[model samples]
Target: MTASTANAQRFREFKMPDVGEGLTEAEILKWYVKPGDTVTDGQVVCEVETAKAAVELPIPYDGVVHELNFGEGVTVDVGTVIISVDTDPGAGPAAAPAAQQAPQQAAAAETEDAEPQGRQAVLVGYGAAPSSTKRRARKPQAAVPAQPEPASAALQAELNGRAAPAPAAAPAVTPAAPAAAPVAPVANGTGAGSAGRPLAKPPVRKLARDLGIDLAAIAPTGPDGIITREDVHAAAAPAAAPSPAVPAEATGPVSAPAAAPEPGLVDVAARERRVPVKGVRKATAQAMVHSAFTAPHVTEFITVDVTRTMKLVQELKQDPDMAGLRVNPLLLVAKAFLVAIKRHPEVNASWDEARQEIVYKDYVNLGIAAATPRGLIVPNIKDAGVKTLPRLAAELGELVATAREGKTSPAAMSGGTVTITNVGVFGVDTGTPILNPGESAILAFGAVKLQPWVHKGKVKARQVTTLALSFDHRLIDGELGSKLLADIAAVLERPKRLITWG
Candidate 1:
């Protein structure tokens, strides 16, 4: 009670900010600071991954960290306090407030987030952000804990007093402790084990429950003995088990394609791994679905001879002026597309359903779709129409590098008017590209291959590639879309068009 209530003003709670375009949630990728660490104003406290991109969040003020409310890999609702700081640490010990106030704060937060007046729900695990203020009081949970373990569950995992049969590589309930069930609940707080309460975050606990893992039985391996996601996954993975332990619904899409492991040697289901979809992948899926269904998409394709463009690309690679830039077919194709947009500005417009109008953008935010370890993200270059070729190349390199590292900012990905997806990189010949949500058009550049062609009345091997343009038919008609695609092909066919048409 000391200073906890009396000096409550000393504790400053920092909530998760709306880090993306009205995104209601983000996952805690990592924490740079911890309780007792000093942090300054604008100091990065943690890195978070939203459905749009991964970004580092800086604390807005200075203080000594008092507590972190969540763990890594946990998706938290925006507006919920993620950390508490003792702004006036010298006044006295402020740690007691975290202990005394966590329950109250958690309750108040739940009520506030759940109130559906202005908030929008986002993502799956982020469902923690309730749609209603009062939670239903469910009582079966209490009664079930009082009952004995059923004989059917050979899943018992004992981390301390006894060891359960487990594959050598991963811990069973010894880490998840679910396999060690009958003995876990009374350990610390439901998550604690015989060794004291187990150290794990709420989302991790939820993962354990979904996988039928007992947290108390999990052996601690994370910093300060906290159980990590890998620990739970490992425990869930059986090396040579005859059958899968978790229910089919809980496991991720099993990757097993090989004929079912020879009967009895190894369980085919055991080879499966289920990774929860969240962050960028989940966002991209929802956006793609909405865009596909809402927009009346019309895709047009054109195969063009690019012998001159391919030759120019080689010359540019050897040019002393463009020595260090990323000189690739994509760079030239992007320039060609930009030139086309310059020739026809109306292609750079969006259909606003609410306003019942076609919004034309004065500036071009050119988006380049990049594939990263996390997922596909399209980060745009600002005011790209005005930049010189070299300057554009520099910005393009930075954007791609940033996206690949999974550090593209939400601001960089927003306000995009047009996009380009280079299917050529993956050796894809061509595809009916889909428009990025809110974008008017997307250009798909296919692989450039040497193919037989009639050149000046003679059969010869020439560089040829395909271009597919997808646009919103409601806003742009066939003629306008055809012109844009034609201009791109003309430029790529004759490199001089960048100067003439550009």
Candidate 2:
């Protein structure tokens, strides 16, 4: 209505971006900025879990946060505005639009008659719809007044009143002065006596519901008394225990494991769970299936004595050149694979189905398959072929750390030329690893075991392991694949060849 209001600040909406592999949607795992926080360009505003990885999204502009469009754990579609930022905070509030003014007036009227529901009011266009369940009656002494309390005091009163049970000797306060006087709710339900809502992300709340665990029963372990996923899982563990044995007549023999029930006969309330395939696990599954079916895989295995490689790993740990770096047999194996690629560059090629040609890579973007909590992700060391051994080790260490922390960026996992999966960590003998999509080869390193071997015509115990290399038949022939794998095996067998061949 006034000039000051006419020149009010305009809000800008920031949409969620596709963080990896053209992902369509991502769940908001955590929000860093609240409604009133100031944010700068490139400042990370929130962490989102996509189908590929957990990515931290950086705001592209400087502004004051106006409102969040979605709550934590809600999966927001790509290109949907997730947050609104006031670009010109110095400007005064804009006059409400004609359509919004009527709604705002109606909301205010509704608020006047509404009782304190012991939960924060949900912002429009965010969070789950309010439940239809009726609120329990308030205590006779805890009546709310017609007037609303100030925002800050109301928030504090709600927090303190709901945090724990009130003492029996506490004095009753009139509802009109609720803010200055803390009024406790009547104990009836699991969440009764709490004026504030339980602090939990959407996923944790969903987990609690799925496990039929009461959030109020579990003590909070997160910051500011928020319940975490671990806390909910801890509470569910005891309840998840199996029920009394089913009668033999109802099932089958008790000694033998019960047969899987017929499709429609399965119990709906069975103890077993069926977790949905989504996020990283879903993407990984699709990729593996495509790679397995599309590519004509040719796998070759070789048993090699890696005693020298094991000794070199120990020696490098003590070496000043490799001090403070990750020195492991995997490092040497990766280096050996790189050297072998140089010797047989044809193996470092990708088959371009669209162009119907072999694309040979001059430099290697060495990929290491990391098994993370999310799923199996292959993040590569960029320009690994050119990096010195120490630099390579450092990059490997950083890559593994980032992957483990679920912070591996989309860029880090892209453009991989070849991959090495260390299945040996799980004590696997060897595996025919499928090629990473677009790459020609993936090498599987098996566990090293002491086996009897002929040394200069005498039987002796030696550290031996098996290596399996799977490559694209279209781009890499049997001869080229064998030569490349043999070279890698030879380098590991001697360990000194890394210095000579490298």
Candidate 3:
């Protein structure tokens, strides 16, 4: 049926829009509403992560949330109807004559490529996603409002076909059942009125039910001498023996459930599995592959006597101002790179092949290449050149934590002007690092260890580390790369110089 036939009022349905350039789909990370949550136009309704980034999606209509089209973690094509606002449901489009004309006018006003009316348009670069053509499956209207049930109670019903009562839960007031009075002892086994068993709370009884043991059989051992999970387990152990034995024969004999099927003896292979490609893993893989191939990489390395840096690291960690901050060797190295990039600005520029020109970014978007189980993702700190030392250190910590947890989105990982990979975390001295795509340079920070070095023209013990710089040869020339790397080394050799240089 057409939207006009279904409702007299002109209501709008908001779908997932492609928010990034060259984007096709995004994962619905979360939904902030159910069927009936009242929402205003522009209020955040959901969060979606595309191959390029994660973004908060806002409601386009001010109305009650009539439906949520997809669950969290489901991938939706651009323009899919993810949410709908119930604007005067059943009133039909005729109810709002002016509103109907408005959409037609809006659609007519746009170019042929522009999105349809009543749908949110895809934003460019951190904007809304493109409109999807796929229609969402509508669910039947509920007889009553559905409230979220306790997880434990739901799990119990799934396993045993009976919902277990939660601890201290208020007695449910259903349409069929009258309000239950305070639970009275229902004597068991022996007699109705012979002081048959010790009285316990309703939850204690549920615990006994889940264990598949009689409540009267369990001996209470908690404060006020109530039964606990331990008590229930203890009482049920002997009864649990039968459950374990049934599985043994399924394995020992010609097994159907416990072991794999014999070559020719195939049973019904019943079940469908859908795997979702969303979140950090999807974002990371795309970013790494893009960076690896698109950016023409040229790596350069330098081994420096960083004894002074190590000493400074220790001194800073102990200082009252830096005590709470993470004063690591990598933090200092990242700071030094930020400072040096100012002098050799060419190293911080990107080669735009399509434009046939170098795009020089005045502000530094410093990315930290983080290795996560999903893949390698580089989430950067925006405008790092302007932040203080402590602020930079804190931002790095947050960036690393979010990337590792697979929570970093495409937006945070994109638009990086330069990148840093701390190879030192892997206990390696140094190796050439790849430049992140769309950026001109990547710096590798290597492990620091006591090594022999010449100090004041004599051989001596010194804290040493290696630094590697990989640049897009199409943009950054050898001269520019060397100057940037050397300047970083100079900062490490003389940590005190940054104060004077800045």
Give Cα-based local distance difference scores for all models.
Answer: 0.77, 0.77, 0.68
lDDT of 1 by residue, 387-448 (tens): 89988988999998888888899999999989999999888889998889999999999999
For model 3, how does the per-residue alpha-carbon lDDT over 315-359 read when each residue is reduced to its tens digit?
888888775777788888988998898777766787767879888
Worst lDDT run of 10 residues, candidate 1, spans 178-187
lDDT of 3: 0.68
- TM-score leader: 1
Model 2: per-residue Cα lDDT at residue 336: 94
Clashes per candidate, residues 3 or more apart or on different chains: 21, 1, 21
Arrange candidates by TM-score, descending: 1, 2, 3
Q: Give residue 464's error in model 3 in angstroms.
A: 2.2
Of 1 and 3, which scores higher on TM-score?
1
**TM-score for each predicted model, relative to the true structure:** 0.71, 0.67, 0.57
User: Model 2 Cα RMSD, Å?
Assistant: 13.3
